[model samples]
Target: MLAGFEKSTGKPPEELSLPWKGMPDLKTGEETVEIFRSWRPHSMLFNLPNGNSMALSHEDECPLHPRSIVVVDDVYCIFLGMLLENTCDLRSHYGLSRQVTEAMVVVEAYKVLRDRTPYPPDQVVRDLQGKFAFVLFDARANTLFIARDRDGCIPLQWRMARDGSLVCSDDPNVIAEACGNCCTFFPPGCIYMSGDHPLNKIRAITWEDDEGNISSVLFQVDLFTRLRSIPRTDSSANWAGVTTVDGE
Candidate 1:
């Protein structure tokens, strides 16, 4: 998997040399799809949002990924981040504009797969670094998969320590900080997963009340509290006695 990812990305796997033999694996090819679906489930976060987004980051400037598809245990997932540069209707479901739609098309596309894949728990984390991200989960196969844009603007890494635990990183320092070892980077447009992590719990966020008036979601008190935080430059003292006799 790592080798294929390297070839696809045109570089060796982020952490391994010519090959990536260090990654973990659990042979599940022989398992029945129904049995696998009933058992361990995973998540697929192709390019998850960095969670720290900058307002200045423009859509046209973002990196674009070619239309591609990868299969995880016969579960098919595809990625086509945008229909064209800075334009997409994908986010109409979320009430975002075309640029925001194209910008988030990658994320929404991944989420669509993640939701359909039917993984156990957060077994597959389809995290996005910022520029682009996607994920596909196959609860029926206990596998998670992903892909990313070509640019290095986004970050991803993982590492194994003396204890055999796999430590992942979005920031390089996290690996060394937690594992006391150097971290390995996940190649761009590559995939990764965690095996044997039980998914006994899964929480799905659902929206049901768009029917509720907008006022129901708004809190005037909160707005007033925020307004109070603004610095005041003018005062009542300035107008205490400034009125002209003729009111001119």
Candidate 2:
């Protein structure tokens, strides 16, 4: 399973780190055996493009809540790390008049996707108060979306495969094993989407401005359309000062 990554990254098997809150397990003389087993039962693996794959896991004792994944129809969503419910806008939106659990939020997100809510996914994400990250994949549409909480309390990382597929997970070591030095942290307060071009192409749901600061104003308009208007620049500098909406 990791052979492709090992051949591509050239870091060999010993240097690799297990994805999430786990470590690589190697026997004597650097003989690779297995990856560190996560204490959290919610950990899972997913198939990515170009034969690549991704995984999500968390520390059972360290994290406030266990991570989880929910699949609704063609959409698969994974929620990792903790959430601050009091800061979440559950009462105002999604018609959730009562307290919510992590599973409830997952269901609501699935509903939003099924209903094709008029609002951008980022808006829904903005209303979610948490120190976490999520990856949503629409199998039928071949679209992959990722989002991180504003404070970035939880970590998410990604690396491009030799086949140009994007492999993302919450573990930097997982990325390191796959990408070597090519791995990087996913930006906070931003929604990343790879539409149609799910293999290697990804664009931030953001607009460019002279001040090098991203303002929340763009959230009021059609986000995808806005992304279309802006020129496709590969530089991350354009993402500087990008702002995300805060819930009331």
lDDT, candidate 2, 14-104, per-residue tens? 1122221122321211111123223233545555443423345544324464567666565666777666764356645666655665545
lDDT at residue 143 of model 1 (Cα atoms): 38
lDDT of 1 by residue, 88-129 (tens): 333564455644433344444445545754432222222223
TM-score of each: 0.31, 0.55
Question: Which residue runs of candidate 1 sit more than 4 Å off their true CA positions?
Answer: 1-89, 92-108, 111-130, 133-141, 161-165, 192-248
As a TM-score, model 2 comes out at: 0.55
Displacement of residue 208 (Cα, Å) in model 1 is 56
Best model number under TM-score: 2
Question: Which window of ten consecutive residues has the lowest lDDT sum in model 1?
Answer: 239-248
Model 2 clash number: 3
Q: List lDDT for all candidates, in order.
A: 0.30, 0.44
Stretches > 4 Å off in candidate 2? 1-43, 46-54, 58-61, 87-107, 196-248
